[model samples]
Target: MSWLDQVFPGTSSKRTMIDRSQALPGRTTPVAVPASHVVLGHPLRGEDPESSAGIGRFPGYQAVVLAGGCFWGVEEIFWQVPGVYTTAVGYAGGYTPNPSYEEVCTARTGHTESTLVVFDPGVVDLEGILRVFWESHDPTQEMRQGNDVGTQYRSAVFTVTDADADLVRQSARRFAQVVADAGLGPITTEIAPLAEAGGERSDGKCRDGRFYYAEDYHQQYLAKNPNGYRCHASTGLKYPA
Candidate 1:
């Protein structure tokens, strides 16, 4: 057994990525989502996917998917943000379609624990949102975060548009320097454009990048449990002003 197995028990094999062909065969039906956020009281997922008004229900509202270690803590952080409308935890950046939490834990699903954040663009700039993302967790720790060791815990940013992807790249570049100055290694965040429309393949991998909402118990988990586990390891370096 490797050191990771000795430390984490079942995570030694989970540290590596699983090919789509070898991933778990998730169900066609998605897991049930909550009606509304427990803390924010906002609908969990009533947004119009075809709405031209904006990303969410309202005009000028934007949406971005982020994965930084555990979704519970990450969702909690964004829900408290100034402009955020709602936060939902789920799986993305992998091939499994509507995968279950247990399946994702196996790391064969290729999905990282992710949070979908919808907010008013006018109230909070995307840069500020990105700053919170950078400072909250150490993005350099690939395939793990703190004691959480697995491909499911990997850091990533999945954007809705190419423009947003470009902006994320810029922010990553800036934060990379900040982390470097703080004596950390290079970032390993998977920054990419989410395939919002028609995200499926013959191989059964959800390469389309859709944000599959996690099971009901995981939504606002920190708020629900209050004393639940929350782990986020940061570099303690502030993003450039």
Candidate 2:
């Protein structure tokens, strides 16, 4: 076993994640979220594919950024969805700009580890996307997921458009009932416009101000290292079909 394993003394703290208060200030300089995805072999900020004139085509796809758990597993789940075009992990809903992984972990950045998911509306609607988000993790927890504790691990949906905000809220209401019936606590997932996330009164950068692509190694991490850790704890409750 490694030193970390030895220090934890059979506990998962060595394995568990940690961070500080969200109110703390973050660094002024952005950590520079990079481009280029690990699995997609393209820039993380590329334009969506054009849909042809056909029943299968979906023109002008919309994007939504989400946060749940460690993002390693959350990203994998979305990428595997039938209508999903691409998924990239990053930091959002925080005070820092281009915050680094470590910074976000400290909980000072006020940002949740996030994933940007581009999907075809014709194939999967907003409800479908929300379904995956709700099912993949427990929303009752605030600023934490499973063993991972920090604002970076908070459950949130950062919508790219104003319309998505409404849909996401409605979806949350629908799922909250299921959670209540199951004896779970109230859903505490944060719902906001993509732009509102990652904003701080102290700093100017905010409003989904250009998704900062996570470091190259962190991109599609589960795919690259199949045996790697997956921290997601999905609630297993399906959205009302």
Candidate 3:
């Protein structure tokens, strides 16, 4: 057995193995909100001079979570986009709390390597954000992006509000048409409504899925490690005029 099995004790070898089965069709999961909603009331990262400086500068910022694949490249792509206030990499659409990078990579957690993008809506519209997202990765690759194969790499947009959800659906439909016109296969990105922040389900139980901030060193990984592997693909395809 490996060191992980030794440390965790009850973990089975088969349980640790990654599952590649595509998520079931129309399998709708409730989107739980992060435990701490208000940044000032309960900050995920306590008052650090740098983070405070960053947040203070952007008063009208909004948050959106997107899961593409291998968040290293996804986060890098959004960090460079104009009007983005901040970008943090985390695990979402999963059933584990505070999951480690290793656990998420194994695919058992049901989490998708995702990025939380804080941007100024006044500067960049939702459509622009979706445009960049759709263009940056292949949405049709079920549960996989390039060599990264697992549920954690599945394409998804986790919207926090009804308006955001509607926009996502509309934009996806338009993008789907564009892809179809270009002779590409159908877009398979998942769109779902977000649950209330820190609320338990109808069973009066808290689900295991929670956003765990990745290791400090993993933050802005591509910017830190310039020669990192990037699996992103762009068709150079534009939306129909």
Candidate 4:
């Protein structure tokens, strides 16, 4: 298929990510975005739209942003997992405000294709969630996940709190040795607090930025198109219970 085929299209192996520095120069202005979520019908930013929409927060529900290659599989996996409230695929850890799918695929926006996972801690704690994340793809391959090779496909855990940041780092540290013991080099996952714009500081830490949802076509894409492309590489390592 031509590069013009579509973003994360068919099972064809042609879809691949490129290095950030070697990618196209993305724009300074974020592309215009949709207002409401296609699947959940919630505003794409700020307060929990599901909860605010009157469904009310699921007991112990919390949010975290995850990036591991194409978000189609990542988002689908979480959506099916128990304890998940809702999931939305979007751009994260990037400079552009609301980058378009084309801009992100060009590897210019500095954004990793991300999944916003809202879950109920009562059923699945952070460790359970992180386990699914680690096992989902090869984190050692920096700046890419398998054949999806670009900064946008890089493995990342964008945390909203300092405590969550520490948890991610600690998990990465422990998992690094596990991967090494299994002969993989090391986990190249980026564990950092979400970048924040100026004047967004609170409690001495800038909160996670406004999550710019991806184009309508990308939301719960696999669910909508069951036979679409899916490239997930699980390491088979299990997280501690």
Better-scoring candidate (lDDT), 1 or 3? 1
Give model 1's TM-score versus the native structure. 0.90
Poorest lDDT segment (10 consecutive residues) of candidate 3: 49-58
For candidate 3, the TM-score is 0.71
| TM-score list, all predictions | 0.90, 0.78, 0.71, 0.74
Index of the highest-lDDT prediction? 1
Pairs in steric clash, model 3: none
**What is the C-alpha RMSD, rounded to one decimal, of candidate 2?**
7.5
Q: Write the per-residue lDDT of candidate 4 for residues 150-206, one digit (tens) a residue.
A: 778888887666688889888888787788788885787867666442113443422
Model 4 regions more than 4 Å off: 1-60, 196-210
Better of 2 and 4 by lDDT: 2
| Model 1 C-alpha RMSD to native | 3.3
Residues 128-210, candidate 3: write the lDDT tens digits.
Answer: 88889998898876676766666778888876566888889899898888888889868878675434212355545333333
Query: Scored by CA lDDT, what does every candidate get?
Result: 0.84, 0.71, 0.64, 0.69
Model 2 spans with C-alpha error above 4 angstroms: 1-36, 40-43, 47-59, 198-210
Q: Total clashing residue pairs per candidate?
A: 2, 6, 0, 1
Order by TM-score, highest first: 1, 2, 4, 3
